[model samples]
Target: MKQHITRFRLRSVSAVAALLFAAHTAWAVDPFTVRDIRVEGLQRVEPGTIFASLPFRIGDTYNDEKGSGAIRSLFALGLFKDVRLEVSGDVLTVIVEERPTVADVDFAGTKEFDKDTLKKAMRDVGLTEGRPFDKALADRAEQELKRQYINRSLYGAEVVTTVTPIERNRVNLTFTVSEGEPAKIKDIRIVGNSAFSESTLKGLFDLDTGGWLSWYTKSDRYSRAKLNADLETLRSYYLARGYLEFRVDSTQVAISPNKQDITITVNVTEGQRYVVSGVKLEGNYLGRDDEFKSLVKIRPGEPYNADQVAETTKAFTDYFSNFGFAFARVEAVPEVDRANNRVAFVLQADPARRAYVRRIMVSGNNRTRDEVIRREFRQFESSWYDGDKIKLSRDRVDRLGYFSEVNIDTQDVPGSPDQVDLVINVTEKPTGSLQVGAGFSSAEKIALTFGIKQENVFGSGNYLGLDINTSKYNRAIVLSTTNPYFTQDGISRTIDVYHRSTRPYQDQGGDYRLLTSGASMRFGVPFSETDTVFFGAGGERTEIKPGTNIPGAYLKYAEQVGYVTYSLPLTIGWSRDSRDSALVPNRGRYQRFNSELGVAGDARYVRGNYQFQQYVPLNKKFTLSFNTELGAGKGLGGRPFPIFKNFYSGGLGSVRGFDQGTLGPRDVTGSSIGGTKKFTLNTELTAPFPGAGNDRTLRLFAFVDVGNVFGENQPIRAGEMRVSTGVGLSWISPVGPLRLAFAQPVRKFAGDRIQKLQFQIGTSF
Candidate 1:
């Protein structure tokens, strides 16, 4: 019985011990304070990095809350894929598996884009190399690649990206792009263009079907910008005519299945054409009704010219604006009588509240100072805004040549409807030019020249020029300056000092040169909106260099010619041009009449020249221009004709079929003869280059020139004139204007024939 009780007690004790062990196992988790955290399966990450990511520190409790937070933070860093926390006794360990970093990015078969450009595009979307690799970024890069291709008209381009994992926890990305064919213009059709023929209307579009000159003009390429510009041209063409209500309804651009061909269709609405019956003005004319009425160019019983109407409205507004009416309005109310198909315009003017300018701000001049541009303004701060003066200021700034572009913008002052601030923006260009040229002519066999000129000296809009020419026929040194506005009231001033020597146009056994040195000052004052009067006086000294070439008559008068003479000249001129470029005037009228009277000089004379040039557009393929110049020189006070002022005509500027300065009367040895009076008439029919399409920069022209020089008192006769007609090619090059003409003499006298081919550089028409 004793043995049984002992065994039972031992069994009970054993069972109790077993129960205690099970309880401990269920209740006791290893109490741990995170001593450190370690990361595994990482080639680029450090152990301390993993520890730094833990939320609980070495002596802190590591429970599910802290452990879970540590793991969540590690995963949020995007540097790991797997994260876990383990506790052993009083130590905790944090483990993480790091993601791969991008090693390098490359492009394959990408000829359309540069490597750096693709890299920049990818970088914009977080796909740059050395950043963590993500599948989303790679997909975005592919889309961006395709978008860039579309901008270049490669609509069918394809892009693919590949991510390759390499050793050392790094990845490499590759973008493969296939740039398909470029979209080309297959057809461009215009509808509802009845006023102009289809061929004529189609010629206005810059984007066109493939032509032989497509390589140069690139007109066969489809571009959205080009289509929009073509629409504007169409509108302008119609408005310039009588169609004032023309509109572009829609434009459709369709691409083919292959995405290599495109078709464009333009739909327009043609409106009724109207003629002007009469134009009447109703406004507060400021007691100058008659003066304002004369400014109206829209006459009675004439075609309704949109240009004329706009001009009339502008004139009225300008007059009011000049009187401090900053907010002026001029409306052209057209009264149409359909029965007679005539329109009468009543120009209604309203001069809204008048106010002075608060301030003038200058902008867009990155290289120029504010004062440089502000000085050109005619309308000052705290002064009334004059539209006419403002327009004149803009023109003055444009003529400076320092600015590539000049514009004036008016902004209304906040809370003041009648007040405005003017802002002048100018873009600066290279203002200094160095010109060096060498030419060979019959008169000046080998001539070399150099010129240094600055149109806008230091952005001041003042001119300084120095020119030197050395040749067998002539030599000169000139220093000149011009201030477009010397006075505050828009008066211009010019100063010149020059020394010139000219060899007489003679073939006889005589050498004659004239040495002339002079200083002149001219002041230009506005006489009207389109006219200016220039008056000046200067002193000149002429020293006749005696040589064997001197004519007998000139030598007889040379004894009294070597004297310092004081002379005054007065000139009045008018100009009105609406061409986009002054150097190559296309459609404009230029007229001028200049008269110079030599008062109180050794040789008294009066010289006058009247010139008129008109440009007419016959069709899309042709532009006809005509120029006429009539000049007369009369001796005053019983003085003989000045031999130094004789006129010589020929060469590229006059008759191309003749030599330079060799077209007039000649000596017995076939040399040029100079005269005192001249007359010339020139006409040209300009066309596009054969294979150059309608490139405005290159043109071909057929011209006819008729002119001659006569004695001072001789009668003008058509029989005594020389006529030449020829075909010429011209180009506006970066170096300047270049021309080459192949001419034939239609009518020639003895010793009048010259080289059939003539070429010139730096010449403008």
Candidate 2:
């Protein structure tokens, strides 16, 4: 029994012994004055640490109480595993066996997490290098590591800790892990649901049984967080469909004994559906009762919908906020009649108090400058709070494309009733990227392209980029920069310098090229909140090189305008974009118009182009989009239209199923020289990719393309357009937007080059 008790007491045996000694000394050994002190058995710890914690020092009176207190205090320090106190002729001696220091911490068989990450986690739990090592602490760390693996669905993962004592009382620790297969969700059952079928209800959840794309979507993995999110989605689905008293009563998750499969069962109660009988408002409206009533979205004749009620209350609160009431409260109180299965909504509003902003605070911007974000805000400090301006300010910051998240919060001032502070919280993201591409070929063998761009250079809210391409067919180097805030009023300025040497057309084998160099500056003026107008001018020289396989049209142009031609091109453009996303837009409209003129050059021409795009969402998974473009050019001062300035259309971007830039009139050598007038139309219907739930980055699109480039004198006629219809895939990849099309021409003339399949990156129609 004594041995059993000793084992059970474990590390506390020393404390128990010290207490017994103190009792004996009080009874038999009398207290003595300590004249000197000495410490022993310490390896790495300082002596002062022990001296400072002692209850009685040198020349001080010692007693049983002080002896007991000293033992307790030293034990609490955690640096020593054993401590003892002795008194010999008024000279006290302290002995301590110090705990071994942790010289190193390591892990084995970890694939899912980085070693440094695990070390940091161990450090948080008081187990790390340079710290005292204890068996209890190592056991706690082992448990924590197992918990981390369990969170990743590895239920069978095992962690074993190994400790090796080295020289100088230092120990090394290693956590060897055996990570097993992940637990997949084998079954998901929704019970107590009758209004909707089991399949329909399950369809709303992101987690499910195994599917073809399970590996990519990971929807079959059992995650507590994902389960909770799915449960919320299920609740919302029923709430939106007029289930007034619906709720989830219980959820149960079970894992198989092998730890490779999981089963989930959810019990829910779907209450009676109700229809709205009437809607009323019952609160202060600040003398704008009519306007406040207009914000109501509830329809008396329709079914009761929680979404409409939430929208109405949110609108009411925003309306009150617009009048400087920062602490406004609005709610929709539902009156349900069980007998008739009907409900009525009463909107209650309270405009608490009017307040103005005392100061504006910004945070979470580790790299971006404060001025970069402040200039985007329209709501100023020491002014009345306006919801419209605040919302606009958030949108503007988001549109900067430099931040991943932008948020604003209103905080009340302390001891002040009519003042508040606006806090702007921003999360920064990588605002720069470098892309390099290389390939091997014969003519353009060893092709390489290196491009780099920084949208927020040094946190100054400026854009800088460099593009370099080296290939036999096309080679160019360009530098560009933009200052978003050139002046105090938000006008932007951009500069561009480029030198190019390339064969812009595919004519079998061509050592021929066009050498061009130029520089330009542009200024953009914001015409409105959604529109911007730009105007710029530049001077460039175009030199045609004579080589084997060169086109006859180029030779003719060179003879007429000499081998070298210089032009000062004047440009103006305007754009209006309201799209929700630039890469994948589901609902919005975009319009742009640009025109250029070669005013003082041997090659005198005026060119204009216009584009219009509209996207309409037909349903949750389908979108209908249309694109239209038109171009026209004319010669000035009786000079013929410059052959170098032409529009080419075909292949992936326009009129797929035809060769790229091969739809226009061909020269005598059977080579495409392009055309001066062009028109194209694209109609597409996009849908969700199969087995990939809720991933908008990948999608399937069926498009019909119709367009053709016309000669300088040819009229732009719809009947002459080449048309094709096909299906394709679009993915927003890390490199860029990738598009692959498989098309077949529906309307085509003989001698038209046919290319049934095409692939491209960063081309949009």
Candidate 3:
């Protein structure tokens, strides 16, 4: 009975174990179906975001592989820090900890860069205010800030970032930067240089020791770009002086242990000096071999001059381009014989194709219209390219004074071997000004002057000017207009109207005033690129007012003629101006001759004036200029000297150290005298400041001036003229040219001299 009961209990236990094991296997193997998905610990992310991120959806089979993929997808959004997946029966749950959103960004102790610039820099690295904050991005922002500071030579700068959590699942970031002392160049050294002195080479660098202007130009700051430029300058200097194989082998910049001092070392290799032994030309002559030969400026047996070689090559290329060979290539192949230290050049020319201008485009002229620039071009579209005409067109644009920069570019047309396009770019600048000022002198206590002028009206290259001056000694009004291009052939037209009054200079003597009004029209015909001939005609009326203190000679003339007048006059003039600047010439010549012949007038008269000026640049820093003027006037038809035609000299524009219009013939009361003939000479030497950079705008000048006035009856004598010597400063400021001078009368007649110091504003010497 015991055995049978034990066997039944064992069978019951086995059945219960089998049922439990079967139930466990069924629960594990049954396919899990998700009825809904729940997300928790999400503040910034929406519930739909997690649903969209899940790999498994409702009614889909849920497996371990799909659940792991869902967690990874949620984390990949970068908006969540922690993601988890849970399963309960047929329901799936997703939990996510969203990253904190950036609330605000703050910077502390930032003077090197503006707030906006820093914000931009931060945003570029994904650390903006509204984006989700991350540790890696914040660290990257800190590193970028430090790098920027280092670029500015602040090698000792420090940057720290702080992240603070705020309400509404947001955080604030603050970047604290400490900009330390900037590294300075303690010394610079050159190695393997024997052709030139180290000091001479150092002088060519724009990066130098600190100077007064270093704060503005920041030349004391070190930069890789500046170093490269300095290296190029060094190479150019050597190559220009016959050093054919000059090169900078390597450059090294060393910083001190304290990060406060830097030393630059440049290793250069200066090879043998080369002398030209011979030159040969091989190219199509275009039936002008003699002309091409004449264009070769590089001479054999002279030191190899890179400039002359380049000029010869360019001349050959230009000659070809003028004949529609736009793709011509002229290569100057130098054959160097190292043993003999001699070089030979072969000018090889290739005329690839004869190309025509397919299109003419104008750009970069924001203010000037396209038509204005196109009208000035000598080269036209749909025509054979002419390099000479294109160069001339560029020069004309440069001379307009309305553009600061001008350039021309050419591009080949696609699929068209014989076609090219030309583009012209220009940068426009202000060309109009209004001036109102007053001048003080012993003769004229205060002379008020007003003037308005526009060199380029509406970017049309036309000129208009109005001038008015009122003073006790002189008064005048003038209106003038000039059209630089009145015709397609480069002829200009000018119209002028003027009313002028002049008072005779007298010291407590007789006073005299004359009034004259006239209008003139002139036509300027181009004789050459740099020369012009002008013809004009005008009519004028003159009335003379006699004063009580007239000279005895003048009184006799005044009794004979109460007033003198002229009805009409004709004028002819020729001018050539090739100077770089009209006010202060640097390198060129200016010549002008004008003559007025009486046609039909009450007081028949003839007057002529001739002026010549030349400027020669002695070197990069020194220039010498010479000026000469001659004037003559004669009264015809038995008329006494027309008092209005007399000449007076003094002051800044003439012989300095004397009052204006006070250096000529004087009345009985020791007033200034007027003459019918005038002669003057002026010379100046200009030099740049020592130790300054290659800025030619500021300079010092030494000058000598000699001038005098003589009557028609009197002969011109060199002894009668007054002379002055002086020194002056010239600056090309943004406002205009400013000049200040101090002069001493070297040849002063008794009781005729005034102050020794003379100065003028808005004038150039």
Candidate 4:
């Protein structure tokens, strides 16, 4: 049978509708064996693409069902704008109109986002250059552009897409965007919060109506994600304070007609506050009930705290998993007494069948090597699942600083309840940094410094660093490298080479100079997860040239040890850090001890130093910190402590009000000659910067500093110690930690050089 106008056009189309139309007998053709197959309207799409989509091949039988299937399959590819099939005397011809290829994508009038950002958003919706163009795709692109603006509180933004057809069946697309004023949060109201004042409850939220720092924090911007998070915070605040049944009933966000202002209202119910009556444990505890009981954190007669309940349950589950019960269940079921306003908790635990790790897999390491990450894992394949070891392994990987995220997933083996697989997933990040800085001062004229470091060299977990400093008074070039995992057991090896030349601190040229050149090798042995001991040996050569204004102590030492001296120094150091955070530490302690011995050298001596730091969080917005450093040196084998190795004090890191390296014994010419013994104490009270709210990156601190350096033969005394108190600003800037201090010395000797104001980069105290 033959039919006229056999083609069926499709638009805003559905494959099912096309299929049903072709299946009708009135529009279908009789079944026949195909003699040949051909594809039409192919500009860039290959002929094989059409052949692959057809249900039946050349010389194959053709029927109504086969033709319908063929048409649906071709349309689903999205490569064609229209498709039709014709059958004449057993020869099947597939005809299609290809969608126009986008020649270019351009954006205009977009000020908030970069042009490339908008293009990427368009590409995400399949409307970029070289892709097929259609009206639906254009509409999607416009919607995506508007969504991007909406996320930034630009609800009034508009988008217009223009398509221009060019030669060769291609089109040039342009998206014009208009971003209006951002919607500012004008008011926030808490409808029903009584236990705590509305101001107190609203203070817990990061979002606010407006503030002086709003331009920087953008806390006045309205976002659904932020609102949801703030609501969760509000809920948690009440739950922790014994409000057991607190809930948010509704949240309303209202916008002005002009779309420039928004108002938010949250309705909440603050339930009755209850105190904990008792805590009881139920279910199996693996016969270690005594050990498990010690993990309970709930305190009877105290207010009910959801944090404590959660901690107790998680502790039980982790303990069970530590004993190979990987699938453990733990819950805190509460019994509430409404009349007495008291609650009791029953912790239920279940230890399922023990599971063993059948295999361990690692993935998502595109740039890093497998061995680099595998060596950090403590959990092994074919071993009983130990949750403690797995958590330690994850922490060790995170400490490597190579990955931004690390997760360990446990999967049960099919048909085997006792076997599981562990998959370690890692997300890699850049581990290299380059720092450049320049400073001007009266002593150093124009100083410049550059440093480059790579913590994960070639993804082998090695460290390579270079430092260069150019200044009038001091110049140095240093090169260093370290292999953190030099041995299978995690012993580290470091090698360093450096050359330094120092002159007296002055703006003009100096006749005297001190040149030092050396190389060293160090080995670090980890004593524990938080402690490491390092030992090294170095060979150094020091040359001293005599001229005017040189320190008298230096001349005396050089006369005894000669103008040139060579020394072989042996170094030993130990450090332990349990700080919770490296920046803006709230609570923690750090200690370091180092000793240097000139075992075999022309100028033999011994020196040792110790440092301690402690941070105590006073509250959410304030911290009390203390730092103390002590140093003492002595002569060994009848030789004095090397004058060049003397310690200096009274600077930004020490007594801030005094001049840099100026608080010690002075020569006849009044130049500071550093001392062989040093003692300094620093105390600071840190709080959030004014107007910044809870932003931790910027803070203000008030500090008190006491102590000074002592000469080799002088006895240390409290009367001689200089004292200063001041306020300062601490910012975690892009370059480094910066501290600016304004100090006034309350106790100082007449000869002391008072700086009054000083600042430095890259030091905390």
Q: What is each predicted model's overall lDDT from 0 to 1?
A: 0.75, 0.87, 0.80, 0.86
Model 3 TM-score relative to the real fold: 0.74
lDDT of 4 by residue, 1-765 (tens): 223333322221234445776666556567789999877789989999999888988778888788778888888888888887766666777888898899999988889999888888887888888888889999988889999998899999998888999998899998888898999999999988888899998887778887787887788999999899899989889989999999999999999999999999999999899999999989999899999999998889999998889888888888998999999999899999999999999888889899989998898888888888889888888999999889988888887888889999999899999999999999999999998989664335587999999998888889999999988778999999999888998889999999998864432234777899999988999998879999999999999878877877789888888889899999999999877776768899999999989989797999999999999999778999999999999889988788888888887888888887788888777877788999999999999876676788889999999989999889999998999999999998876788889899999988888888787667777
As for candidate 2, its clashing pairs are none
Deviation from native of the Cα of residue 692 in model 1, angstroms? 5.0
Candidate 2 TM-score, true structure as reference: 0.91
lDDT of 1 by residue, 202-307 (tens): 8787777867877777778777877788888888788767776789999989999989999889999978877888888787666778878988978787677777
**CA shift at 346, candidate 1, in angstroms?**
11
Per-residue lDDT tens digits of candidate 3, residues 1-765? 888665434322121233344235332324578787776687767788888887778989876556556766777888977776545556666666788999999999889899899899988888897798889989899999998887788888898888889899999999898888888777789899998999999888877766675565566677778889999889888887888888899999998999888899999999999999998888776777888889998788887888898899899989999999988998999999999999999988887899999998988887776777887788989999999988988888788788888898989999999999998888888889998987764456688999999998887878999999997767999999999789977788999999998766555644667788989899999888788899888888777666666555555665666466666888899999888888657799889999887768675678899999899999766899988888899987887656666777777767776766678776565766578898888888998644345556667889898998887878999988899898877777665676667788899888775766665555544
TM-score of every prediction relative to native:
0.66, 0.91, 0.74, 0.94
Using TM-score, rank the candidates from best to worst. 4, 2, 3, 1
Q: After superposition, how far is residue 416 of candidate 1 from its true place, in Å?
A: 2.7
**Candidate 2 stretches greater than 4 Å from native:** 1-78, 83-97, 439-447
Number of the predicted model whose TM-score against the real structure is largest: 4
Quote model 1's TM-score: 0.66
